[model samples]
Target chain A: MNREIQLIKRPEAAPSHEHLKVVETEQPEPRQGEALVKLLYVSVDPYMRGRMSDAESYIAPFQLNEPMEGGVVAEVVQSKDDSLNQGDIVTAMLPWREYALVKADSVRKVDPSLGPVTTSLGILGMPGLTAYFGLMDIGQPQKGETLVVSGAAGAVGSTVVQIGKIVGCHVVGIAGSDEKTSYLMNELGVDEVINYKKENMADALANACPDGVDVYFDNVGGDISDRVYPLLNKYARIAQCGAIASYNVPNDQGPRMQMHLIKSSALIKGFTVGDYQTRFNEGFNYLSKWLKEGKLTYEETVQEGFETIPDAFFGLFEGKNIGKQLVKVSEPSSN
Target chain B: MNREIQLIKRPEAAPSHEHLKVVETEQPEPRQGEALVKLLYVSVDPYMRGRMSDAESYIAPFQLNEPMEGGVVAEVVQSKDDSLNQGDIVTAMLPWREYALVKADSVRKVDPSLGPVTTSLGILGMPGLTAYFGLMDIGQPQKGETLVVSGAAGAVGSTVVQIGKIVGCHVVGIAGSDEKTSYLMNELGVDEVINYKKENMADALANACPDGVDVYFDNVGGDISDRVYPLLNKYARIAQCGAIASYNVPNDQGPRMQMHLIKSSALIKGFTVGDYQTRFNEGFNYLSKWLKEGKLTYEETVQEGFETIPDAFFGLFEGKNIGKQLVKVSEPSSN
Candidate 1:
């Protein structure tokens, strides 16, 4: 028997049990050039929030009454293709089910020796590459420049903060809670962390970046992004990665930035990891090297069991995740 | 004898007669490494409006109770350096005075055989360089791509519109009046012209750019820029040259553009011509060649008399000029 979670309805704000339903289904069988896999971990990310709605976006919305799909780590239990073995661990964009019968082309083999298999869904995955290209290719933070990262404690933001520091920039992070701020400062070695929830955000950001912002990695947009507007230096670069705060409705925006952009002679570029799919190997290789050298660290708020996947996804908006948020469906077959 | 205009006070909105004063002064003598020049032509630019105010910008604000200085074509009457001689035509950042005593290093000799000595203040000067680099280096208009230019009849904007047409782009122009629109469509060969003052800007823009805007040369950056924001295509480029629309009082701006940028994966680069000062020789050479071949044509709204310089400057804010607005201080001594 296989248990699967489906999107029963679209959520207006915070997703609840009404929007998602878990169902027991028959175990799926594989055909030629296909494999049957048992999911070991399920990843929940903020971009999934964009896919849950019927709103126009880069990617299509998840269909209601169908199984929802996301980044997943699973072990191949039955194989029809000679390339994949029964005990092989793989990563795939598969449905939130205990077992998945998918074509061999859908799954990618993740090396088990690279920290953990779940790292394939976090540091070595989309979030890591998003930070790498968005910051390096676009932001191009120079030495002694002020680099500010909003959503500083999340998977992508934490990685960006470290990269900014390594490149000799002064890194300031903006996060929702004091705990998240502490994580960024203590573990990530961020120069300054603003607890946007408690502090006067604009003042804190201004005080932190007195020389003005040279590069901004915008993750959580709205007030945080608005506050950074007045502080941009000449030729400043903004890498717009995500707008988690406004992902729900997306209507409320602050004052027009063209005047400020004119005054500073700044640049803003929006991108997705899919934009750099050809360069995935470069980012992933460097990321694995950094993880081994202890230059980067990551945390995951892991929920237990397959049924708790929806709860874990909703917890992302509540800021419950420390870095990456994932659900532990089951232990590795070998372990 | 010398008569010059001085800035008495910074203007709140549109400049008035009270903001500037005319003062008659004695002839200035040149010291060692200096030359005495008799002013012939002076340039009145929109950027000077920012200099009149104390607001912090890329360049220093013009000081009050002093003769306002800008791009001028003058004849050297007295020279203390060996390279300079009597009756030499030169371009310099000289005061508004009828005769200016300036350092020999402060001025460069102009080749009148290139086009016109006044062309050094119009098509071959800062406005020309502004259009050249802003459109080529940043906007990068591709062949068969849709390009929209605001303030399309002004100096820099007109040059950009012509360049867009020359580069095999489907060029659409936006201007404030019917006459300006006619000039763009009929003479400049702009594919479409939207009279912004008469039509619904958003609808007209949408109708003009059926394939969506690939490159936008933004010269008037308030509501005009806002209307074009919605019609941006994926990977659009915005070359922000000026904000003439909000030059007087910058408080009234529309909503922020982060969401729209994210949707289209666009890039907006705000730049001043000063940023490309190093590449001036290359652009000037090409511009001179273009003028000789009659590939580019220019119109100058010449304001006669040195005493009427302030009126020509005010004419910029009121949109009275068709192209480059210039003040004729005097006739060139020999040429």
Candidate 2:
């Protein structure tokens, strides 16, 4: 038997165990030009909340009943194609299944030497590339300028905070809890950390960035951004990456910011990693080099067993995990 | 005797004749490096409203009891500098006085061949440079892209519409009055016109740009802009130039737009003409070439006589002017 999680119904507010149904199905076989992949680690991200709904977005909505797809790190158990061999580590948009029979061309080979195969999902994958293009390309933080990162403990925000420090900027991280704030401040060496829930977020952000914010890496958009807008200096730049706050809202109506952008002569640009697909190699080289040089460090919260997949996903909205949230189903037999 | 309009006190809301004091004083003689200029056409712009109150901004607040400064097309009556000559036409930041004693370096000599010398205050001046840089540098409207301009009858917005057309973009102009809408449609050949006051602006805007608004040249930042934000497509660009609506408001609190920018991957950038000082010559040359080719046309609502200066300036906030609002204090004898 094979195990997988399926979206039995759409989430009303925050996703819970009720919204997902874990099922056991027959193990799938690899056809010609395909590989039978056994899941080792799979990612549960904030962006997945958007895909679970039927909202019109950059990507298509996740369909009901079958299986929800996401970035997965798996091992080849069997191969019918020359490109992939048994025991090879790979990354693909594989469904939430213990085993996935996918076309060889659908997945990319991963080298374990580049940290761990798990880093491919956290620091060197979608979240990493999101932080890279959004911060470097759009935010364009200058030395001595102040940079503010929302969702500072999450995968993308943590990467953005480190990059800001690397560029010699005053980095302020906005997180929800004390532990997350301490992790950002003590471990990551972030210049300041504002636990948004503990204090008046607007006043705390202003206290943190006394010189005013020049660049903002916006991973979580809500009241945190509302507070950030009024503190923007002239010619300030905002990289709008994710809006996990309003993803669950039936209608994504939040706040309006035309006057703020106009008055400060500021700039807010939204972008996805897909926009920088052609420049992935450049981003990967820079990120990997920094990781090896000890200039960047990352943390992940992992849950073991295939049965705990839905709870691992629900943990994302509850802020139950720090850094990247992943579920460990199995370890590759050889590697 | 020299006549000039002095700001007596800051107005609470819209400026009226009561806020201004017309005075007759002795004209000062020009010193070395100074020229005694006779004012021909003095402009009363929306930006001046911001300078009236003690608000911290890009430019300092106007000092009370001093004749308010503005764009002036004037004649050099007497010169102590070799660069300027008697009867030479020049453009400078001159007070609302009949005679202005200013440093010769403070003024740029105007060529009469560039349409009209008064064009120095309208199309060939700060407003024109504003439209040029905001549209080209920030908006970056490509060929076949749809562009929407707010305050379409105003100096900066009118110029933006024509340039959008010249760049092969489908141009849409939004104005308060039907007359202004007709002017944009018939006279300027704008592809679409939205009478913001008379129609459902959002639905009209949606109907106007069926493909979706790509570049928005926003001059009036209020309800019109509030409506435009929802209609942005993927990679939309908003050029924030002026906020006429919020200039008088004590505290500038309007909409919040992070979610929209994130969803559409759009861009909103605010700018001033001063930001493009290095690129003025480039903007000027292009504007002049286009103007001479019969591609751009401009209108001015002029009030003659020095005594009418207060009323002329007040007309700007009332939406009484269709295009550039100018106070014609005197006519240049040569031109």
Candidate 3:
């Protein structure tokens, strides 16, 4: 028997055990051009919360009572396709199951020679690409200009602050805890770090961004964003990447921002990494080059066991993860 | 004696009579390069509200006890310069005085052959240029797309809707009254009109735009904008031209829009006409050609006397004007 986690019910607010259920199922078999793989690491992201609801969005909603799917790193146990050999480690968007069958074309072989295979789900994958294009393309940071990143310790934002620094900007990071703030300051070399949980946001932001904010990489949109808007300099740019603050909270309300936008003549563009599909090679080349030169780094908060997937996902809204949050299901069968 | 209006006080909420005061002063002589001009038509605009306050804005605040100034059509009563002759009608940014000395180069000659001298204060001047750049550059209305214009019966918006129609779009106009709606539909040839005061905006918008909103030229930002945000199609663009609804209302609050933007991958750009000053000639050429070809038209809601300028400015918040609101102080001394 194989274990699988299914979406039992759609969430109206914060997701919990009541919305998801773990069940037993028979082992899946591989057909032509398919490979049977065992889950090694499962990626849990904030955007998946949008798919949990039945609302119309950029991506499709998860089917009720069906296995919830997401980015995963797995090891192939049996292969019918010539492209995938036994014990080959691959990453693909797969369902939450201990054992599953995926078409050979759907999964890409992980090049471990570059770095660890897990980097494909974090720094070297979607989150890194999101940070790259969203910051370089939308934010358009310039030397000596101020760049503010909300959720600075999260998967996408952590990379954004580093890129902002590499581009010679006055980088300011806003995070929830002292540990996160310390990491952003000491490790990431951020110009300033505001512990939002302990500091007054408006006063702290004003103190941090005395020259005024020029580029804002917004991941957590709420009162934090409200404070950042009034500080935007003339011709500022905002890369609206994620809004994890509103994902779990129903009917979130705040001060209207249209006037602020008008006063500053700012521009805000909302996008996902998938929107840059054709330019993946361009982004990958830049990111990998930076990583290889020791100019870029990443971190992961991993929970050990498939049963903790729901808890890991739920912790995202609570600001519990330090970086990329993942569930380590099992070690590779052969390495 | 010459009459001038001064900002005596600033209001925390709605602007009223108490904020302005009328004073009498002596008319002065013109210097060597100066011409003494009498005010004929004074333009009253919504953006003036931002200047009424002492807040740091794109333009300077209205100094207390000093005369308020804006775009005006004036007649040269006496000329000490070679550029002007007696009775020449010109347009310039002038103070609220019946007769004042202006440097010859400060004002431009208004060619009456274009339409009328008053057109300089309406369709042929600032309002017309605002409508042209805000819609064409920011909104980017493509053929066969859905273009929605808020404040559709007002000066900038009225022109925006006509341009949308000219671009072969399914144009939807939102206004406050049946009179305004009928004017937008019949006179401007808008494909659909919504009297936001009478109909439920969300339902009406849904019925009017079956395909979804591709471009939104927002002039009145408040509840109307909230309804339009959720219906934005993929890669939509919004020109944040004005927020008349929130200018007087302090501490305005509404539903957050970050999620809607991310879902649609939309872009919102806020700008003023001054931002496009270098390209004014391009905008002017298009507008003049369109007017000459009868593809564009304009309306003016002119109040009598200079004393009514404050009231005309105040009336904008109440949606009392159908199109360009101006105070006709005096007719042209000649012609």
Q: How far is candidate 3 from the true structure (C-alpha RMSD, Å)?
A: 1.1
- Per-prediction DockQ scores? 0.49, 0.43, 0.89
Q: How big is the positional error of residue A299 in model 2, measured in Å on the Cα after superposition?
A: 0.6
Interface RMSD of each: 1.9, 3.2, 0.6
Instruction: Report the C-alpha lDDT of model 3 over B87-185, residue by residue, as the tens digit.
Output: 999999988888888888799899988988888887888988999999999889999999999999999999999989899999999999999999999
TM-score of chain A of each: 0.97, 0.97, 0.99
lDDT tens digits, residue span B1-335, model 1 = 67888889998887779899998888878888878889888998998887888877788888898988899999988988777898999998878899888776778889978878888987899999999999999999999999999988999999888888878999999988888989888888889999988999888998999999999999988889888988889899999888888887656545566666777788999899888889999889888888888878888889899888888988888888898899887887675
Mark the regions of model 1 whose C-alpha exceeds 4 Å error after superposition: A1-28, A52-56, A64-67, A305-311, A333-335, B11-18, B23-27
In model 3, which regions exceed 4 Å deviation?
Answer: none
List, residue by residue over B167-253, the lDDT tens digit for candidate 2.
Answer: 999999998888899999999999999988789877898899999889999988777887887788899999988878776665555
Task: Give the clashing pairs for model 3.
Answer: none
True contacts kept of each: 0.56, 0.56, 0.85
In model 2 chain A, which range of ten residues has the least summed lDDT? Answer: A250-259
DockQ of 3: 0.89
TM-score, every prediction: 0.92, 0.92, 0.99
- What is the alpha-carbon lDDT of model 1 when measured against the actual structure? 0.87
Better of 1 and 3 by TM-score: 3
